[model samples]
Target: MPSLPEELKDLESKLQHTLRKLESIQKALDESTIVVITDQTGKITYVNEAFCRISQYSREELIGNTHRIVNSGYHSREFFKHMWKTIGTGKIWRGEIKNKAKDGSYYWVQSTIVPFLDERGKPYQYVSIRTDITRLKQYEEQIKYMANHDDLTGLPNRRFLREQFSKLLKETKEEERLLAVYFIDLARFKNINDSLGHSVGDEVLKQMAARFRTVLDQKLFLTRVGGDEFVAVAPRVNYQSILAYVRTIQQMLARPLEIEGREFILSANIGISVFPFDGEDLDTLLSHADMALYHAKEEGKFYQFYHRTINQRLIRETILESHLHRAIERDEFILYYQPQYDLFTGELIRLEALIRWYNSELGWIRPDQFIPLAEKIGLMPKLDEWVLSTACRHRKMWKQRGGVEADLSINLSASHFQIPGMAKRLLSIIESNGDDPCRWEFEVTEHIMMQDSAVVYENISQLKEAGVKLAIDDFGVGYSSLGYIKKLKVDRLKIDRSFIKNLPQSADDQAIVAAVITMARQLAIDIIAEGIENETQIQLLKEMGCKGGQGYFWSPPISETEIELLLHGAE
Candidate 1:
């Protein structure tokens, strides 16, 4: 118990200091890393407290067991083979590893395994260190999902569609089977958007997409390529089966959708194209499907299959669409004036302006041929502006020629009607051309008005306030209720030619025409009969007290020069 020598005392103090340093190092390692030591054969020998906590196993349970006990099965045999090759050669192996816990939960880690070497420089034991990266991996997976899926409908997006289509097409070709690519368009969805508003329209689309996904079965892949447009691919399908599937898809789309307590029915135009038959490539297949969809809508059918004929029509339409913008710049559009007369007096009261395109290369493209194409390509607004400005100028010139005083009626397409500031734009065009707003009338069909939007009403109100007359064209051909017509506050109603052509012979037509005239008179709205070809139809119209009329009988659509001679003041 006596005091020791100074040298021995100093050695004892240094030993105690070294032992404390080792203890601190061990504590630090226990707190930070998930450490495990295994024999070369992968049997666990030691595990730190952190490792046990992560794997939900006690140290005693982990030791003496194989590392395979915690295998998540997420990695392939090849992955493990590469890992083993690295560590077995006494080299440090680093990788991201996913492991399963005792309670069947998963975790991710960035791991490093260091192999301990024997005298022969071969591995005898391995020491592993891991940093828990489960949260980071989860975030990465979520980001990937967002990138591949549409935010609105939660369906696969265009990017994902292309990826899957590429993979699926390869698989189909290898399996020697045909694949069907279907392009679906929600018909008249714009009417819903414009009338009910975008919010309701979104809900309707969601409902449609949900129904489509629900009934599609596991074999088909559905994607939302864009607004109101969905693309789907069905593998291992043939002509008969593909046609049956299309019929089912269309019926599903046609199902009623309830929005804001009202039942709404939706219709879709579906276009189908087959792999290797339509085209072997993705772009070609999509293009052919789109063409078939256009043809389906053209034929007023729910679905159409791509054929060589559709390809030809699509090429022609494409050429026309590509040139429409230039057509306006080149002054290829002309206006024809169809004169309306007093039924009894044959007095020219008004002239309806019709647009006819004279493409320099194509030579006189029909309005029906190019207008819908123009509308699709966003050229209708400009084309409409050009037509209106030209018609106004023609009317001004007619006035200069022989004092023509009849109102000039120009048709405003639905595409132009949807423009935000259409009324003000029209007013500017009218005043610029030295045309009287009161003497110039705008014709909008009932189908356009049936949309019943606040914007439409506002535009109409603004036009009328500026002394422009508005008429409901093709009166009975649309689905508008009488309430909408009353709300329009238009100056006149033009009886659709359908009712007039068979008048005085067909009882139903006679009754409808008579009722329309009587209603117009009661409402103080002037009625004009359209498409009067013979004298008997004119007589019947005159007797019905229809004050104004226009048709082939008076004169077919005439040029601006011919209009001057037809003016009452000229003669």
Candidate 2:
């Protein structure tokens, strides 16, 4: 061989050094990256050590097999088509892909595929460089899941609900089916959460979510919107089918739950709105459903369907509720007295005080309109205080001028008793007015007696101990147990007006009245039939051995001045 020239020798040395650098680069890539070389038709020709380790496959097993051996089926066929089209044209394709290993575990990779081209600009082979990003992908998925699900119950959350609502709405409309959106509020959930700790509450919520899931069909979606409130969206076949599904949910949730060795019987109030009927938009539908829920809770119904009248009524109530906070400060409240008479002799025995509101902006709002509103708005305690103080003031006025010989009966709100030591506070109000507590009767609904609260029990006990008379108003219409009546040692059972309105006519009402009277007599408790409108009802009550009654027949709830006139006639 001829000896090389100096220029040729230096050029060959540089070329050798450049080859060494390229080899070093290849070695570094093989160690760090999952590298694979494939023929133009996608037959795997070579796989680096990193590719073998990540794929849990030997080089021999991966080679000549193509990348399909690691296909996870996560990416769509179209996704792979796009990548192949790009690489086939001698362009680099960069993307993230999910692949399965030989052990059947899935891994994610950040991949870049570069096509080696012939001089004709056609691809002859492809080299793929992939970075194992399985952990990062998992972390991203975890973040996405946490953002869309509730932490306590691990249920899809409100944001997820909103996102899915549009899709569900579109599907329902396309199928010409009704999409039912159920807004569920767990009744008495706050009481449980407050009495028992949040840990117990959280466990109860989780159990509730699990039970809810068991009842839901695969097409139905349940999301925990917030504390003790969940929403379910489902496509229904018809009105009847949706109602049947609602009943099924009610029945399922009615089953008793146990947590931390304590058994709980829970109930839910559900409000529903249907797409294309109640509303067409997500926000409108959800708003209407929430309005229906308010009415469900207000009317004490298990579930309520959305109607246009509910929105109107809710709007009016909302306006009234806004003004109600100032009604007390504005002195818009007044009390009217109705005489309770002895059934046989027509002698006035007691005066029932009824509250009425006369707002300046909204004139003459009925007690039926604002009393429950007061209770709902947490104004009952303050209103009760005003009633107590005002009643005492009126009695002091009546006694100073040839007094009336009748006990003053005032209706007490259930929420008033929820306040701790409220009974003592009320007694102090009566004492401060220099009135005789013995001459006053505090009447509460039978529902109040059924509340399982120490504060309510203590309040009732304190009132009874202070020589104030206790009466169970609306006796037969509520959930008050016979044992509760006996336990409270109530002085009177006021038969509800419903039974009295159709008395001596409807056999059911008559039987209920007679049974209640007999039960009250056997319990050695006094009974009064209210809403007495006719002599026939009065005569029948006398025959039933009822001693006292009050109704519109004798006198409608009257002003204090009119009550004084009735007192003069009685005297």
Candidate 3:
């Protein structure tokens, strides 16, 4: 054994070494974590550099204060009370805390509070170690918000709407109030989106969301369900009140919205379903409202309510759409020609080609019934192609069978002119079939001229330049714009059958017909009075200076062979 003095020196050396290790540990903790020490009364006694830096406070400022100096008030009093109770009983407490800095900025921390106990196992002072988790909490909150809100418009998303729907339904039931679910669809929004780029489309949607917000009252909530569609929920409303709200929505949306320095006149078809009357559940109510919206769009109306008849109509339409997809390949469509004659001489002037469909399953569908359906399902282009091709084939046959030098009038869909190179495509179809453009007159409605598309104007101009005859079909019934008439420089204005059906018998019809004829003559355009069924009507049209017409009085729309016989006799 060594001497007692030497042993004392060794013990002192070991104590110094241990003190150095403890100081190194304290420095590491100060650098890596926010460390603060307080007395048994919760008054701060010391704070490390990390604590002062994270709290945006000087050590001198925090030394005498409690943790309440940085309290954010984000937690309930009970939360802090429970935390203090745990540490005050000589126990360590672990949890997350939200705290505010001296600059009023908020932060999050993962905190562990430890109590230093006295010999009696009672708390003396507390030490808190915290790790900053502000960034992690922000990421979590961002994800949550993204899940519940629309990124483009900052409105509640469809998922959030569905989540809140049940709660609202419960409240509505308890309060004995009605709820109206409005399915609003923007009309012709596709045209805007397709013609312009998506950036403009997105801006349009954002502006619409802002406008919709202006109309929202305390009882109403609006949600963007998807592209060009929004749902408005109105609670505590009766039928009349719901209608009033709909009118408000209509009027608010009707105001012209200027986007990207261009003005757009917007309209929406609103479909409404009242609670406990139309449906009790969200899905059912939304479905019914959608059905109403479909009917409103079909009927050219602003708003409609749910009814059972719409369900049946929707079913038939769904079946028809499915069948129309296979119509061309199945060769279920045919063209019938109706002859136009000179009213004074009873001579054949031209043949108007009308389409007729005989589906294998749905037999003998009228043109009026299937034509609009075809247009709705985006099959108009294909149907128009078929019509042009078949009409050319018939004209070729007529020429081979010693035909007269009369034009073949074919009604064209307004959609045809929407294509960029529509004139070239159409003329290619006719020329490929060995037909002359001069022998064909493409008849278009007055609404076709109202499209305001550069493509439409370009196509019409191209057709006119290529020697194809253009005529305005159903003239008086549509929006009669004198500008469109003069701009198009059409070859003929076919007097709408409505004015001619009454003829000399009805003075209003005669006055309308006579006015149309006079205007056509002044414009150097020919006029054809259609739906003529008697000698008196023919004489009246001749007296009005109308050149030609076609109706049941001369011949109904006849078959290819029947019109071919008429063609031979006309020669």
Candidate 4:
């Protein structure tokens, strides 16, 4: 070898420094996230160790191969075309991608691709950096599914329905194809849910959804919009076809469902709306369909086609909902006290406080109408509290005015009972009354008791211990099982009006009433027969050894003044 010049030695030193720097860069790339360099044709030119590990392929196997080796077949041709259009212009493309591994397993990656251009500003090579996000992708998918679907029935939810409707509206061409929207409300679902509990209710809904799915083909979309309510959208169907489908659905729903060794007759109220005829938009179509459903339910338990008249009712309901909150604040509610008499003594014993809503514009709105709306809107707890406190205050006033010794009975809704601190609130009201806790009776229906026995038992037990008498209202009509009655610590059993109305004629009704009375006697619980409209029914209940009775036969639900007059007269 010849002796080296000073310039050549300096050049050698610089080359060694550059090699050290390049080695460090390579080592860093190997340890960092997944990085790959591909030629202009997308053939793999370089892959770091992390890339090989993530794809479950060795560097030697991946280096010479094309990127297609990890193809997951999830992306469409259009997707790749658009991606290439952007990156081929020397721009960056960022997206989530699913890729197959060497072992035939699939993994998701959050990928970013940067295209490198030649000196002419044309794409020459592409560099992609990715992070393994398979687990995170799965979690996101799970959350999306939960948000758009019902866990119990595995059906699409209201949110999903709205999205589908929006998509349909965007794609629909006017006068080209018609969309049929069907609103189905289960006829006896609440009754079944009340009698059998929510677990059985959930099973019933699942089976019902399955049955609904079986009757429709791939073109239809079904969603559960609310408890006991379902909506179906059938695409490219005319009015007549939609009506036929509705009839078919009604027939399927009429079939009996066997649950927990009980045969339950299923029925649905269906309402139909046609696109461009009933409504030109999604909201209008859904609104009309719901209106038609209400009409069907009102007319009979079957199907009905949409009509213009139904729209008016929907508008009215919407107005009601909008103004309901203001109605509560405006004190549009009043309490009516119906006197309950002792069957043996023929003396007024207690006055049951019934809520009545008197709207200035709508006049006297029936409790049946607004009470359920209140429960649905989550206002029942507040209403119940107001009723309790007001009735207690009224009872105190009546006692001070030389009225007969009478307690106040307030009806408690199932929703009200489910609220946390309900027992404490009741106790506080009773304590504030300055009266015997036993004098304040709380009337709860048997349906409410069957919902969650453990929670209901705990709350009722607390109320009972605090001196509030617990009475099971509408007793014989619901699932009045002995187990629940015993577990509930009940002080009174008020027979439902349906049995009382039949009285001596129907043998089955007589048997049911007699059985309930016998059970109450055996359990040492007092019995009160409500809805006693006739002398014959009253006499029959008295003969049956019922303890207390109240109905129109005594007097319709009266105001506090009227009840006071009745009590003083009885005294």
Candidate 5:
């Protein structure tokens, strides 16, 4: 026992060297990424520096703490249950997880967890390695947003709407709540662009988007389905609630907008469709809402609830819409002119070019019904081009006839303003028609002027340079400011029918009309009052020094023949 052999002494030195290597490995493990070793029960036996750094806890603090110490509460309890089941069966589990740091900050990590088995293949300890990937997750989110959102309005695009609609349909049950889809189209946005320019039109769209946001709850999902058209999806709401929400939105939209010192009163036509009641699927709901929206636009401004009759009308509309896509190619669209009279001189001053669609199956479809539908479906631009080109041709023809000069006013929508090269396109249309831009008047709403002053200014400047006349139609209903009015290089302000209908009776109404007339006079802007029904209203407006007036009291919106007859008699 006193003396050892040389071989035994050599074995002892080897053992000492092996122990040193093991100690070095243990030190390396302590500094590695989220190195964790736990007992089968998931009690922490060891945690590394990296784990402490990510979890905001010291090794000592985590050693006695369970895995729950870093739980971010993001994963469901079932997630943890499944994780435990897998590890208990001696399988490795890997996944990305969100965990709370020691200071309550959150981090995302890719984790690989392994369960070690004893000699009998029973569970012993578990080891986990994790790498932080929060930045990567953020980048992924950014890319997703770019793909799903409208670049100009920052609202969900049509693609996103379809995806969300599918998901929502799956999640909602027939009994749980009703789903409603609202189709919104801005009224007369095109007129604004034609007169003031696209820059102003784009500004109007942005402002409208912002106002649309305010009209809904944070939970409401809104999407820009097309130019000047938005779809709002209200999930888990009752019919009453949906109605209330739409009313609120209508009120918000009707609120006057001020831009460049001009007051723009903007109105929207909203159509709504409910789930189960309207359709069981996303496509049907959207289609029906679109149909209802068209009817609302034709009927009047504001919102309209969906009904089954809308579906019948929708089928014809779909046919019309499908044909509209090819209408330009087929040459099935035509321009019809209606003359506007100079009240005092009894002569035709201008002619408004209106679009009419002749479908093979539907006969002649009036623009009052289909133009808004085209706009909601993104066919307005094509329709607008047709109107512009056709009107220019007609104007040239009229000019060739005995020096007959009549200004042409072509209606445009807000969406057209957002299109690139709109100014160039207008100029090309004018040149192609061989018509003078100086004799053309583009009518727009005040809301477009209030949307963005810079864009409005630029577009207006371009149009003015092209020698086009700018007119603000449906005025005194939008947010108008003297400042914006001064900035807008418009020549005319047309009073809206709502004000005209109530004029000379309600003190508030009188004040609004008086104020508008006064403002226009000061700006040297010509005033045209629309919707005069009674003689008293006409007299009141004429006494107020209004320049021109149009209404049922004089004549309803009629054909060129009637307008010519009226004008000839007056002359």
Candidate 6:
């Protein structure tokens, strides 16, 4: 055992070490934590400087007050009850809490409560320790906001849209009301995006969202799901009124928007599905709306409402698209030649090769029925190649039979014409089939203007340089193409059949026919009037200086055998 002086020295060192540790801990608590001590009855007895600083309270004012002085009312009574119960049992409790400042501002805290017990294990005092986490909570809320909103447009995103839709759907069902889910996509948005930069596109979307907000009011909910698509949900409305309101909204949307001095006319294709009629659930409603939107795009209509038949239409289209893949392999296609006659000389000028499909399952399908579908399904290139090869072979066959030879005019689908190296491919097909380039011609509709103009000009120039003739079919139908016709250098312009169906009996038709002929002459482009069914219409076309004509008056599109017979008759 050590002497008395040694024991006293050791006790002094231990006491000094404990005092230094307590000082360090007190400093740490003051810097980072808000410390407060209260009696077991919950009256505040003391508060550290950190608590007074954070709560905007003086130590004197907080000393006798309970935590209710800074109550935010954010927590329920049960929360405080449970917290009190734990502390009363000589246990610890921890949780995140919101508190009010003396200035009525809100602050967040990570809080813990400790019970100090007496010799009997009964709580005598309660110590509450809290860390100010207001800034951290703010950051967390900001992250949550970004996750639910579109960054570019600052609109509620798909996730938030679905959540709000769920709540609205429940209420709508209880009210026996209807809800419309509108799926909208811009029509020429892709072309605009490709032509202009994405910045301009973003500006357009922002302005569009602002415009939508004006028309939406409080009843309609709008969200920019993504890209050039948006969704609007309107609840507690009937069908007809909803449709009318939607139309007004569309009219507002269609108004031209000017960005950086450039004007853009945006058109939207809208699809609407009503709850309790189209679907009882969100997924089913959205799918039906998407199908309706697809139908609107396909039919060139601005909007469509979901109906039972819409699904059937999609089914038939899908089946048609599938059949088109195997069409060439199964030899389901045939070419019918429509004769173009010289209006003045009454002589056969040429026959336009038109494709007709006779599906084994669904009899003969019209070109109007399957041609656009084929293009949409990405079968145009293959379909056009087959037509070119078949037409070239048929022309060679007709010539070999000692038949009168004229150019077999073939109509080119817009998709095939706009493809790069189209001229080279056609020349190769012509050479392979042993057909003369000068005796064959290609025709395109006015839709070619939508393609890259420079590319089109180059392709057409190359084709013309190789002795291949070109024509613009369905003239005067497309309003924008007529002014730019000189760029194409087409050899012939075919008057659309709509103008001729009314014929000389319709004064508008007569004037249009006369004007088209004059325009054709001025541009050195030969004009052909189609859909002629009577001699009166023929006389009117001739008088208008229309150079060539073709329709039922001469002959409907016929087989090679009939054309061969006609060739013999001509000889």
lDDT score, candidate 6, position 114: 94
lDDT of 2 by residue, 153-172 (tens): 88999898888877887788
Local distance difference test scores for all models: 0.86, 0.88, 0.88, 0.83, 0.79, 0.87
Ranking by TM-score: 6, 2, 1, 3, 4, 5
Show where candidate 3 strays beyond 4 Å: 1-106, 112-128, 191-200, 260-262, 276-281, 398-406, 502-512, 533-540, 568-571
Q: In candidate 5, residue 325 scores what lDDT?
A: 80
Clashing residue pairs in candidate 6 are none
lDDT of 6 by residue, 8-112 (tens): 999999999999999899888889889999999999999988998889999899989899999999999999999999999999999999999999999999999
Question: On residues 1-571, what C-alpha lDDT tens digit does candidate 3 reach at each position?
Answer: 9999999999999999999999998788778889989999999999988898889999999999998999999999999899988998888999999999999999999999999999999988998989999999999999988998888888777898889898888888988989999999999888798888888899999999988888877677788888999998887778888988888887887788898899998998988888989999999999999999999998999999999898889988888888888988999888999999888788888889899988878888888878899987778888888999998888887788787756888998888788899899899998999888888899988888668788888999989988898899999888798888888768899988898888677999889889899998999998888888898998888888999999999899999998888887877
Give the alpha carbon lDDT tens digit for every residue of 129-233 in model 4.
888899999999999999999888889998898877766655555437788888888886886777679989988998899998898766788998889999898
Q: Pick out the ten consecutive residues of candidate 2 with the lowest summed lDDT.
A: 397-406
Candidate 4 residue 316 C-alpha distance from true site, Å: 3.0
TM-score of each: 0.87, 0.88, 0.82, 0.63, 0.58, 0.90
TM-score of predicted structure 2: 0.88
State in Å the error of residue 569, model 4: 3.0
Over 4 Å off, model 1: 1-19, 188-208, 254-264, 294-300, 377-405, 415-436, 465-467, 502-511, 539-548, 568-570
Clashing pairs in 2: none
- List candidate 6 segments past 4 Å from native: 1-17, 36-46, 60-91, 100-107, 115-126, 134-136
Assess candidate 4 and give its lDDT. 0.83
